[model samples]
Target: HIVAAKYNIRYIISGGNFATEGILPKCWHYNAKDITYFKYIQKTFGNKKIKNFPLFGFLQEMYHKLVKKMKIIYLLNYIPYSKNEAMEILTNELDWRYYGGKHYESKYTGFIQSYYLFNKFAIDYRRATFASQICAGAVTRTQALKELEKPPYDESKAQLEKEYIAKKLGISLDEFEKIIHSPAKWYRHYPNNEKWLSFIYDTYRRLFKKEKLGNF
Candidate 1:
């Protein structure tokens, strides 16, 4: 929003779609707009005081949209999107390179999706993507299952990568191990507006829009 305001941009495009993210369970992700929840986590875990963070509270959220006249445009919904074809285009046009798996656009995201999520909560991110892709006709069920049959990484290689990441974060291997093995907590355990937000969403959909996230 800050960047948009600076550049006088009014509309933003969202890549969210049924083809890639439609099957991921809501529990796997948190609302980016949940300022209270964000502050709570940062205050509880961070060492420094939060300052000038680019976020808006629930009340201020409307000011950005209604007052600033900002709008969101979801492009994939109106177009025929094929991941395979898109990847081919990217590879050919931009010289883009394919990594090991989906959402492997960066090593950090790749590690979190492939290793961290599974290690912390037993959530296989690939399963969500694969299922969504199958439903969207991006890939067949057999193909997705075959990919799932293979492990994200060899045990030895995974450990090495973990050790390297620990070093990069300036933490000892034991510390990183403890951090990873620590008890996993659900997002709802902390402060949130999920209930109110859900009510608001249902109300808005009832009064205006007919589509629902759960319907996907």
Candidate 2:
């Protein structure tokens, strides 16, 4: 209680009931993920014995369902890049590793904020591009021609890229354009700031609200 209280947690759920009685603990981190705290959780509850309660896995399953149901209104793309050549490979493969393995790594350093919201951001990106394309296309012929002839990734090319990305996400091009865009949806608000720590804290705030953090 003291430890949890120090972290401003409201209550502590024990794992003895889960392991011994076949109950499962709630996925509290569904609202937020804190590495140092969950490290403590792994230390404390990771080794508890499992029993045969039918509801043991209920909490996590329910949490997943809730997550799928909640609409993600905002999205931001915080693509990390650098002029340094050696960092390119790392940035290139980041998306794959993020959605797959190394997901838990985000919790450790709060580095996964972009990654965690990326699945949604990708969908939004396609949509926003679609809208931008339509707006750009409806312009005068001269402007349209100019857009078409623009650089390697100009408006037209970007539009096609958006369509391709939408297809990859299994969302129609129309769905992409109709959604809203807000600054809140952006993941990389201040990239030039300190060592990504400010972004991490902002992502945390977005995930759990400005009120408080949860207990493990």
Candidate 3:
């Protein structure tokens, strides 16, 4: 029904969740052979013990192929750790210039490198974008192109012309994050705010905030 809505309609974009199960698809899935390749990277890069697949196969193939061709051996070694650790390092700063842990540790930061490969050179770019999330360093090349032809959601750029109660009430980013994270908080924090009531009645919001979250 939302898809059938006409021109100039506004919509909220949900974050691409990486959890194993949810309304969103699974974070990762790729070919079986690709898993073996990641294992190789794990051993050579971080010398860590890989417990499970970091991402699914379809997500892996795009960067995996590039890593193969470029002989990018460093990130492969860190495959033993969870995706969270890998992402933190990639998103944050890691000294790839000098190798402290291993000789190849400086080869590639997983997130940045993956973006470089996927955003720049995948054959089925749209398919790759749909398969992986941005935190995995996967940028949607096709979506970026489409936004060129149409108005893109200016989430980061959006300025509230009218002072929101949430903002005027002097809400901090952390507090706002907390409210959005849990259903209970929505009502608990903003009982007088009609938005919270509307959210509680909305079927989608009810489903999304079913569980009460204590921590992010």
Candidate 4:
């Protein structure tokens, strides 16, 4: 907010693409912004203290919105969009290249999106992404299913990425493998402000009589 105020900015723009948002399975989704829960997990599971990592809880978010007037906007939600066309433009104009799958441009995102979630939770988030694309008329159900028939990522590359990530984190390959094969835990297992957040959201939604996207 201070930065925005300095620049005389009226609003903040975000890339929260509707086509790619809220498609993940609810069970696998955790509110990472819950700093209390994040700290608890870090202390319990993380090997080292991670400092200066910014996180915002429900109250902080409300402060930003209502007090700071830093209204972050997702413009994509207000209009029809074509991810294919956008990608094409980005490719031709900026010389950007596709890295096989969505959100595969970065090693961190790629590992989580393609590897960790897939191996640990046995959840194919791609299916949800494909379903979202289908709803947007970007692809047929058959096309999506055919794509899903094969592995979401190249086996060799995924293995390399896993090893690289484990090495970078100073963990042994065996430790990484053990973590993957271990039982998956949900967000409810940890302390969180999810219930409070949910209650507020539900109350507001009910008062406004707004329909959620999933309900449709």
Candidate 5:
């Protein structure tokens, strides 16, 4: 945002509806790519440079959270398009090909979501997305639950994807597996002003009568 402001690039448009819409739509967006890159850097550099100091890490995390909240706010106030409607316009009017699954356009993201996140963390993001869709009246809760029962990706292609992602990231299969097996960590693990920030957020929400920020 600083850079955008410096360049006078106002009115940044984003396709952030799916974060709230609850449908696990195709993840062919800048934010998806940025997340994949962040993960790659974290694994490649071991987070020393990324985290450096507790205060730095805390500030970074807070900034990220703020940006995420801003995106949702932007969607609520300015951009009023739905995932289904956007896809229709893109496919029919712009002739955009549908990319299969969330973030499938990026092989790294495909591997991470389908194999890494699923196998290691047991994080099926589709569950959240499906719930969102249910809330939005785009899909039924029963249907979402049914879909959640299945594997995130094709079992037969799992090994192939793992190999592909490992090679692409210039990491050995064993190294990649090590990362997968490692415990998950969050920004709150670092010393930070999270409580103070939360207090401020809550205060602002109460003062403005705004809805509390949703979990990403």
Candidate 6:
């Protein structure tokens, strides 16, 4: 908001394509064009040294609840092509390279999402994503369940990635392992104004009709 005010940019546009994906499965697919658009937008208007703001982080998780019921067809307008189709087009026309998994372009992110989240927290995001695809008629439930049963990362590659990450962070592999084994903490563990924020949000919701408040 401060950045927008400084730049006199009135509209806060987001490619919130995941809004319909949450409620309906068929809208779950993402393609290379999505990545291209994101890169283009970032190059055009994104901050070079972005600070991690707590309010922005808080809003990311909470805002989805406000748009959970958005129609799938409307969201489809944002994603007109399939993943495979986009890949083919990008590879052929733009010589765009492919990374294996979601957010895998970043080594740290790839390690955390593919290895750390699963190994430490037992949280397999692939299961949820595959299940969503199943719901969207993109894949069979059996296929998704079978895929879930398999490990997310290859053991040899994961070890190499782990070593690379630990080295990059200037931490011993042993220390990294201990950190990974430590119990996970929730957002409430840190100091924040979420309670007051929630209270105010709820009060506003109560003053207005539920539908008007986008609570559905």
TM-score per candidate, in order? 0.86, 0.20, 0.18, 0.87, 0.65, 0.63
Best by TM-score: 4
**Regions of model 2 farther than 4 Å from truth:** 1-82, 85-153, 180-216
Residue 102, model 4: lDDT of: 69
Better of 1 and 4 by lDDT: 1
lDDT of all predictions, in order shown?
0.79, 0.35, 0.35, 0.77, 0.62, 0.58
Q: Count the backbone clashes (under 3 Å) in each candidate.
A: 0, 6, 16, 0, 3, 2
- Ordered by TM-score, highest first, the candidates read 4, 1, 5, 6, 2, 3
- Tens-digit lDDT string for candidate 6 (50-161): 3442233324324333433211133443664255566799899999999877568898888887789888767666876665565556678788788877788777788789
- Angstrom error of the Cα, residue 183, model 4: value is 1.2
**lDDT per residue as tens, model 4, 20-124:** 564666675766557778888889988886777556666776666666777778898777878888889999999998887868787878888778988888788
Name the candidate, 1 or 3, with the larger TM-score value: 1
Residues 43-110, model 5: lDDT tens digits: 76763464542232334444544553322245543555467777789999999988778788887787
Per-residue lDDT of 59 in model 1: 56
Greater-lDDT candidate between 3 and 4? 4
Provide the global lDDT of candidate 1 against the true structure. 0.79
Per-candidate RMSD vs. true structure?
2.5, 20.0, 24.4, 2.8, 6.8, 10.1
Q: Which window of 10 residues has the lowest lDDT sum in candidate 2?
A: 15-24
Query: What tens-digit string does per-residue lDDT give for candidate 3 at 116-142?
Result: 223332222224333443334443556
The 10-residue segment of model 4 with minimum total lDDT is 207-216
Best candidate (score: lDDT): 1
Cα lDDT tens digits, model 2, 1-216, are 334434655434432211112222222112223333334444553554334322213233334334433222211112221213323565686643332221234332222222223333332122222233344342344553554343312333445645665575567877655531322233123122223434555665678676432222
Candidate 3 least-lDDT 10 residues: 20-29
